[model samples]
Target chain A: IAGITQAPTSQILAAGRRMTLRCTQDMRHNAMYWYRQDLGLGLRLIHYSNTAGTTGKGEVPDGYSVSRANTDDFPLTLASAVPSQTSVYFCASSDTHSTGELFFGEGSRLTVL
Target chain B: AQSVTQLDSQVPVFEEAPVELRCNYSSSVSVYLFWYVQYPNQGLQLLLKYLSGSTLVKGINGFEAEFNKSQTSFHLRKPSVHIRDTAEYFCAVKRAGYALNFGKGTSLLVTP
Candidate 1:
């Protein structure tokens, strides 16, 4: 499909392990975002890229890093995973950084033990 | 910074009954409003949005929301809901060129 795709639908890793959640969009959008969905917390932005080669922090960017070397891919990495980082991660893209609707991927569920 | 608040963390109602999910936001500038629904273990899908037009915005699956600028509220409503409507509903706001700020979310439980 010509939408966002995320890999490793679900994963279990040990604490301090390095992990990466892959996200790619075929829509050729300029804006990409990473959010974590928790039980009570609806969804919080972790990192975002306005365009290729530009990255910015979000409300909860701690413990997470992202790189946007190209327009199609925006991968989020957990340098050293912690149990507190366990949550469902979602990747979304928009046509522009302004008033465009978002298209989201299914999700990547990560569990750190 | 813009923020959203879904007053009711949980709403329980009977099938076929009317329901409302309240949402409020805090922003100093003009913003766009949106409502999204998420099924179990799935990502969020846009339910509806209010950009510039009538305050009453109708969405998919018989859901609608009203944008009350004075009140800073955009509450989701359904005249009659179905079991399929039982899911997590999120209210979000966005300023220009920025990612959305989502509310905690309201879990709607439709019981028969």
Candidate 2:
């Protein structure tokens, strides 16, 4: 099963450009999240959606925005990509049962120059 | 809110040797703890989790962890390891209804 699928397995973007990391899950989960992985800094939450039509800011939401228009998609957009934003982005989803078992995508490696 | 600390950033051990990766968390309210393993170029996969009931949780890949409430620790352990076990291990925690807070991650290197 395609639990979670992300677009542009890797991308190279120029600074100040607009880019969106698309994430879709077929598990019909109620929660979705976006996280960035950087060296030494680990994984930091960017944005999240509790369910359809809802979104919330996470720990590191600056320069990023997300929308959950429906149950299957939660795409993260970088209004103005910066070099500092270059990192491996991961999309994850989980059920509302509270075990917090996240099903993650392979990841999108974004390089902002 | 909850925070996780994985004491070891890297661990090196010989094949078939037992290993333990330390993890500790702090939170005012109750927390759910998890351990995830990421193989090269792969997404993080569940190693095990401690929600409630049993303090000792056994997970896939013959890995298990014991949750210590007094010390606020949930350390992952394996009695004997294989080369396939070498990967990046992450310790994460979350208060109910919150995003998971991950540690810096520990890279496990298994040698022959």
* Best prediction by TM-score: 2
lDDT of each: 0.94, 0.94
Worst 10 residues of 1 chain A by lDDT: A94-103
The root-mean-square deviation over C-alpha atoms between each candidate and the true structure, in angstroms, is 1.0, 0.8
* Model 1 residue A68 CA deviation in Å: 0.7
Worst 10 residues of 2 chain A by lDDT: A94-103
For model 2, the docking class works out as high
Please provide, for model 2 over B15-106, each residue's C-alpha lDDT reduced to its tens digit, 9 standing for 90 to 100: 99999999999999998899999999888999888888989999999999999999999999999999999999999997888888999999
lDDT by residue for model 2 (A21-93), tens: 9999999999999999998888999999988999999999999999999999999999999999999999999
Per-residue lDDT, model 1, residue B37, is 96
For candidate 1, give the docking quality class from DockQ. medium
Per-model DockQ: 0.80, 0.85
Off by over 4 Å in 1: none
